[model samples]
Target: MGASARMRLQLQPPAIMAEVERLLAGRTRDIRLKGELRRLFQERSWPRTAKIIRAWMTWVIMLDALTLGLNAVLLPRAIALSMILPACILPPAALASAFVWTKPRAFWLQRLSITGGMFFILMSVALVGVGAGGEFYERHLNIMLFVATTAIIIFAVPLRWTLTVAAMALGLYLFFQLHNPRLETGSAVAATLFFASGIIATVVARRTMNILAQKTFLLELRDRSRVAELADANARLERLARTDPLTGIANRRWMMETLHRLWSDGMKGRDAAMLMCDIDDFKSLNDRLGHAEGDRCLVKVAGIIQSSVRRNRDHVARYGGEEFLVVLPGADEREAAHIAERIRQGVEAASLPNPASRVAPYVTLSIGVAAQAPDDAIASPEQLQHRADAALYLAKQAGRNRVVLHRPDPPGS
Candidate 1:
């Protein structure tokens, strides 16, 4: 064939170029999937990884441009001008730059471009051997190309895929070298050195991946533990807020909220009742028996009151140091007074030592009862409380240890 015809034949794509493109496309897909997996595990942020990949791509483009420029400079003007090799290469570098700068999802396309560029460059070198008998690889050039390719592959792809592609490319390059045997001993040694360097990089990358995986697992475990501890603490706080510390009954806050909810649900009917009771002469009792005995008496009285009001909706709470409140959602005023009387009787029956006894020789309670129909003209919860408190004041005035009912105002007496 004539020299010009032969040169045109060298510029056309070879069968191997299609295979290189397919492999690179698959590698790009694997790299994208691996990155998504890392993000799913929260091991690395996607934006950060993308920035790093782009920066690495920029460096790779720089290195490849340097290699091509050097190769162009070293070639004789006649030889360099005779081939379309340089033009074939510039497009891939330009695509890679655009991919980096424009931030497109062209990972596969960019990779395919690079693979085609390498295959085309190798073919050019191979076709040149048909006419001229010069060394196909210069030591410095092979070393630079190998370094640049290895860096790009390791940074842009998963470890296994990177190693696989590197192995295939190296094998093909070695096969070409075996056919032409024109490489100087120094060039062969440099190839070997570059090959050794690739092995070292593979080892380092694998180690880094293992460390990243371990760190991710430990951080996930730590976060789970912290969440569990916080949930447990919240449960304990809820329990404390709802329970009376001294009596083990529902606290006033919990009882008030429950009563308001029940009242809103139409529980404040004529059958529902509330009772407020207090230990008679509790301050004198504390003075005579000391606060310790007073506390014991209060505890004992709370237990008795809770026991007397033993229905599911019958709630008792220590209203204050020496007073208690009870809510009965389905009991009349008389039944509620009876229940309070039972509590007073239970305290009297205990007959434990009471040095503060003025009348009963032990602690006694005066209770007040109030009832309301669902249609009653009650303005607020405080009004109900005020009526009960007024009844309790009257019970105390009528002498201790008695129950009093709230008196309605007479109309136009």
Candidate 2:
């Protein structure tokens, strides 16, 4: 095949995978789910892998030391000691690598330390194998050690690092075999079989771990999305509960709670006020103009009351049919009266024609203003509301289209 054609064939798989990734990313927005998946995998798996690698390294180092001590009796003192010295340094370095693994960002350093340590340990054992003898016993023992160490490295470390350590150990093994002419063909074949088995084991273990990690990432993303959707649903429910469906103002439940809060503040030395407003002769207006116009009238009055009370702490609610309650948190009697007068005038100015009966030709409001001083002895939200209602009755009785201040009942009357 031509070089260009060969190159295109080689590039096709990666190009197809890239296109698939792009399509998935476009569907999922700019969040880079694949990148997040990888990050989550690292975060979740790295610590456990580090711990396993550390434990395996410790065991291997100790075993190497013990083996060196045993071989010392059979081999030359110089050769055995040469092996023992390098083996002695490995366990401490392995333990230090465990410490490095505890740092989240030091994963690469930890991997490097672990892979490098395994490479050196295998290389040191290979050195001993070369120097000891060219006999069958020595070759067999070294081959077993190489196979065992390869298995440990592959099983303990992640895929990329395992491949690296395996490559280095295999290279060192080949180098040793090349230098030793006395090594038999059968032993070489056996060593090749062992390396192949380790490679297969590594591939199987790594693939299994990657599959599990991907499943975990997908499950976590689904759970996060569900939680977010639940939170939004709850917020919408809360808004619906607090708002009046007809006029779109605060509902009675929200207004009562707000009034109780204001009462608490009033007890703590802040004056507050309440304005209980009713549409002037609303029943006749509803009967004459139809309930639809009545509903529109309520919505318009609610808007006017909401707009008239400019203070952020002031709250307005549809108290009941044809009635609204305004709570001003810090307003005293004079300020309360002024706000109520403004609401009354605002309703009159709207000039919604009420051609039925006694009030004005246009729609009007009778607002009852009730102010509470910090020291006033009104002990309950009911009492406060009652005082405003009483004033509202007086405003209706004294003719509509005006604000009336609450006058508390005379003592013991």
Candidate 3:
């Protein structure tokens, strides 16, 4: 592998970051992240190894059959027959491995297939040389070593699997070489050592590559977890900015934003309305009780207004101290007045205690209503809000607990 790109800094879960740090710190031999890393590595590694093996198996069968045919046609018949017949074992073995790798199977089953199949392929290569009986015997042994070397380099399985394949390949090379009648003890040992050294080097390199891949996987998990955390944080901040903490309702900022959006030029022909509600004798209630009790009253009143309005079509917000604003879509002044009256009755019925009030024994609200019909030439959202504000001033001036609709002064009088 070329130089790895640097991983970026990101916040992740503590347990995952710990595991990633441990692996980066070169502690590769232990169970990772309480077995979570193990499962994740397998999920990523298994399919990659299977794909390489599946493609290789097809090529192996074809090449083995071609070698057998070519040997029969070009070489002497006795030598060819001996070599070709034993080598026939290779094609079917490769086919069997292909069948296993092409389909998904249990982990243990895949392990067995890889381990067992490598042995079969390597042994068949050695047996072909044995059947050839002369100079071909030693020559075929070299071919087997060469084949094993390639397998070790190409199959990026786990370190254990690589070690197992390396051990089996080296053992087979020595076992068959020692039995050769033409070779002396010294030569046999030398040849085995030479091939064994090459296989061992290849196994070490494969292990390094595997570790790098696992480290990359850990980095990916960190980035994904960080992205999730950032998204959740942003959502919460947005809510806090738009919502009143005391009443658990939308704040003035959100209400103004909604009104501007509804009355924007692009939203022409849409009908919208608002209700400006004030708690009558709210100052007296706060002075009589404490601020904590006032908070409770605000929450209760907010809930009442919320329940009275259409769920999604109307938005209720705490406009400021002792006041709430409601944005209603598609409601005329008459529909708005009806909604305001319902809110008035709901708050009066709640009986949240304001003996100091002049309106009644219980808490009361005075609401002002204004609406924009589809045909009306409302200049801006602020103008509509001003109309509602004017209506609220009128209601307060006339009497405390009542709903008053803002009727435009007759034709600019």
Candidate 4:
């Protein structure tokens, strides 16, 4: 119907507006049944609520005191202080204090408090007409003081609150001015000026808050984006560190770290086995296929070996260019040998296309298996890997593609 409403309707298509209306109707069902505003207020942060409570308390106590004091002292004798200007000072002071304690930060609170104190001092000037016999109705000092008070309110309170207070004060002042024109004209004019000033101040305050909220939101979004970027970088670094560049298996570093851990536990008498494997004729394969093909072949072999070991504690890793290692906790030499053989068979079964083969098969592996023993001389992870490597050499020498189990040297030897 209205221009703004028509603009909004154009922005939202008929279907979208229908959906929005449905959602609003659904939400309003709950609103229509609600009377829990007090409970909602109670849930506000404690310090914020405490500041608001202090404002109301200050208003009650200070306003009544100022009214009584004006009646008793300033209004009565019209002493050095003409009709108490505190009647105007009291409300502004209370409102100023409210602004102080409810300030967003401690720094602003101090600023507002100083403003309130200065306002009170300037308001005391209302006593200039003291000893001038004037009816309370004929008080120009109070009118001037009220104008100053409105200026104080514009600076002290936030926009919405300022507007509300100004509007209320203006309405009452206008009503009184209508009833008692001769007496209330000056004060009425002062009130109107303040009301206009309060409206402007309120607009400025709302604009400032909107700007601050926008900046804060953007800052939070930027921080979250930075965190997400850091997380992605860390994940990429971890993958690079742990994985083999050539074969895509866990690298030697991961293998050594795991074997070191297993060996340490073995020193405490925990059972674990290691299987060291080498691709037989791997040097020949490199000579036959280019380095690229060799790398692809190795990756394929690594996949086969990894699949052969199934236990939770079984770990397979790339030891070197054509070598791999496995750590099998709770496995003896025989069980480790069986796993090695299975891996060997799986590789042999691959039957890859080989143009340059001395033997008929494309690929095969030589595997050496060894188990940790508390009584063994292997005291460290290096010693464990050394023994497995030695066994692997023995397997390569014995035959191209067979599993070999490590046996301790004779005691005398």
Candidate 5:
């Protein structure tokens, strides 16, 4: 034998045995959890199951009509007449059941129609067999009925209804056999055995299919849960990417994107403003007190800036170390300057002690304000940002704790 065949011969038995054990364990757990099976099947597989039932109903109706037609030719007049009404009524009833398949509340009507049709077929066969020749006819008819029961069970109806229909048909068949004198003891025993075997097989087949269906539903649910978790994780990662860890505000990258968006809006006839803010004597604070104290001061200053810009359209970002930027849409130079002044005052009012500071006894800010209207030809967002930076330099040059606005050069300056 080849290497693969040899390996298979050595390995296949253990693998098959292991799989068999696993399946047995799974079957036991499924039986224990059978109460939940109906609910899960309804939630995930009801529509498909309904369609299968409808299709099977159509096929069963066709097959029943064909069998009845053949039997009508061979059976006596009374049996043929009895078969005629059911053959005429059942196909139409099955068609009507198809119409309600989409309506879940009306599902029982389909089940009843299908089970009722099967029961009628069983009764018709029994009736025809009783009125026909002898033991030969009864034996053949019972076999046919067993085949019909097996067909119905193969449609995989829910277990409760399956059991109900099986019980009714089997009980009716036994009653007929007991009443009929021509059915010999041997024939009766054989018929009963066949009927019992078919029912057991039906139950086993339905249970196996149910187990498979439940496993598929569980896998789908797990996949959906994993997808939702992945989506949530992606959202959190995106938020972290754009947010400053220290200040709990927009970071430099987000601020740059906001500047670009505002600049685009500015080109479309809207006004936007930017304010650059620097903590006065931040290096000195970090030097005298520890960097930990400097971090606390930055957090306090960030809160002040965020609170000072009360408009919902405005955003604040930590541009870099000890510096923050604000974007205000639809704001003019005056509004931007006013907002910057409030931020400077708010920081000073907080009275964060800065011993090494020259600006004030407490920490303060130097802010630069720049505004652009739609008509202005500021070629890019960088130009507006540069103007804000220059104004901030001017603010620090003149005084460490004040606001300064950028001005374009006059026509003849």
Candidate 6:
């Protein structure tokens, strides 16, 4: 992207920005695109340029053959034979030069071939006209100018090359007519001035075309870069929306959505279990150590709980203040209790001291396990939460720093 991309306040790669700056500066000067942009522009245009150059060469060859036959038929034997000289020179030069353009070559060599081919072609046309004499002499100069103008308009080469072709054609015409026996000074000056005007116009037209093409290329790059940047920003925002900022784990909203999905799957939810975990005497710990240390404890506990689970199969969430929840799919009460016990041990092993706690001198966890079977009456994930919470209350009542299983109340009780 160029200047317009920079204004968007998005970052353009520094190296690419430098190239674009060079391009914009190049536009107003000699119309030669420089640096990395020049190389890329050449590579981009090469295929089409090759085809056009080859086609033009083929046509020039065919036209020269046709002209040789016509000269043999309509002109004197000596003059027709004299025209044979240019025909021999033109085809081989055109063919060799066209071959160079058809494949990739060094830019300097490419320009050299093209400029040399143009001058040879001009000279061959003038030689044919001189052999035929009279009106054909002036007409051949017009033909030379036509060839140069067409190259300027369609070749899509840089301005310097186009200017080179134009200058050579003008120089050839003025040189031949100035030394001519029949042509007058007044007519020669008028003809030269008129030819010079056409030359100037074609060169200016080619310059304008190059500037516009490079500008279009720059804008297209900027648009692609903006699209990539937008996609990355959207991904970061989505991650932030679903994650708990403090604990760096899944939040309550994500947990609820996942629960809804799991419950809706009748077969899958049948073998699911829920573990609701609360730190033993969390409020007392927070009161004694302040919220900063309490937040540190929460983060540490969340990490331990995550590490203890079955990875992708288990869903973990920071449900609310000092409370965490985990959902285990395809698990029974025994398996759920075992995982919950692991979580309890992992936290107690971390030696974060809570002075007010009656359980252990260090912090500890109490987890409640509730599971669903095929025949059980746990209709939704909320019912699982209520059961686990009930069990959690029992664990707190009996004493903290342990795991408890939720046993449903009997039907007749």
TM accuracy, model 1? 0.48
Q: Could you give candidate 1's per-residue lDDT for residues 1-413 as a string of tens digits?
A: 34553333233233423333333345332322233233333323334445655565566456556655765698776655543343345346544543653443455654554455445443443343422345444442354346446544444434544554455456555554555466655665566566757665764665466445534433443444446558678988998999888767778888788778877887544367778888988888888888888878878888888889956768787777787888777776677778878987888888756666665777788888887644567435556666778889999989878889897887886
lDDT of each: 0.61, 0.70, 0.81, 0.60, 0.72, 0.83
What would you estimate as the lDDT of candidate 4? 0.60
Per-residue lDDT of model 6, residues 193-218, tens digit only:
89999889988888888777767656
**Per-residue CA lDDT of candidate 4, range 258-377, in tens?**
766765655332566788998877777778887787888898999999889975668989988888998877776677778889998998899764456554458888888877775765
**Regarding lDDT, does 3 or 4 come out ahead?**
3
- Ordering by TM-score: 3, 5, 6, 2, 4, 1
Measured against the true structure, the TM-scores of the candidates, in listed sequence, are 0.48, 0.67, 0.84, 0.57, 0.74, 0.70
Cα TM-score of candidate 5? 0.74
**1-413: candidate 3 lDDT, tens digit per residue:** 11122122344348767777766677664424337666656665666787888777777777788888898898899999888667877777777877887766877777777788888888888899898878888888888788777777788776777788788888887888889999888988998898878888888788777766777777676665678678889999999999999988999999888877776747542577888999999999888887888889999999999999998889899998999988787888789899999999999999999887888878999999888855668546677777888889899998879999988787758
- Which candidate, 1 or 5, would have the higher lDDT against the true structure? 5
**Which regions of candidate 5 deviate over 4 angstroms?**
1-41, 54-80, 84-160, 178-182, 259-270, 310-312, 411-413
Residues 1-413 of candidate 5: C-alpha lDDT, one tens digit per residue: 34553233233234433443344456544532233333444645666767876786677578768877787788776756755653565566557655556557555675776567566656655555555546534663565466456645566566767776676677777777766687676777678777778777877777777667655554444444456568789999989999999989999999887767766755432577889999999999999999999999999999999999965779899998999998877788888889899999999899998999997878999999888855677436677778899999999999789999998777899
Clashes of each: 0, 0, 0, 2, 0, 0
**lDDT of model 1 at residue 31?**
26
RMSD vs true structure, all candidates: 17.7, 9.9, 4.6, 13.2, 9.6, 5.8
Candidate 2 lDDT, 1-413, residue by residue in tens: 34553333233334444543454445332323344345444655665676676666667667767787787888777766655655565566556665666656565676777667666666655665565554733573455456545544345445566677666766666566655677676776677667767666766666565555555444554444456568789999998999999999999999877766766755532576788999988999999999999999999999999999965778899999999998877689999999999999899999997898597788999988888755577536676678888899999999988899998667899
| Candidate number achieving the greatest lDDT relative to the actual structure | 6
Candidate 2 vs candidate 6, lDDT winner:
6
Q: State which candidate has the highest TM-score.
A: 3
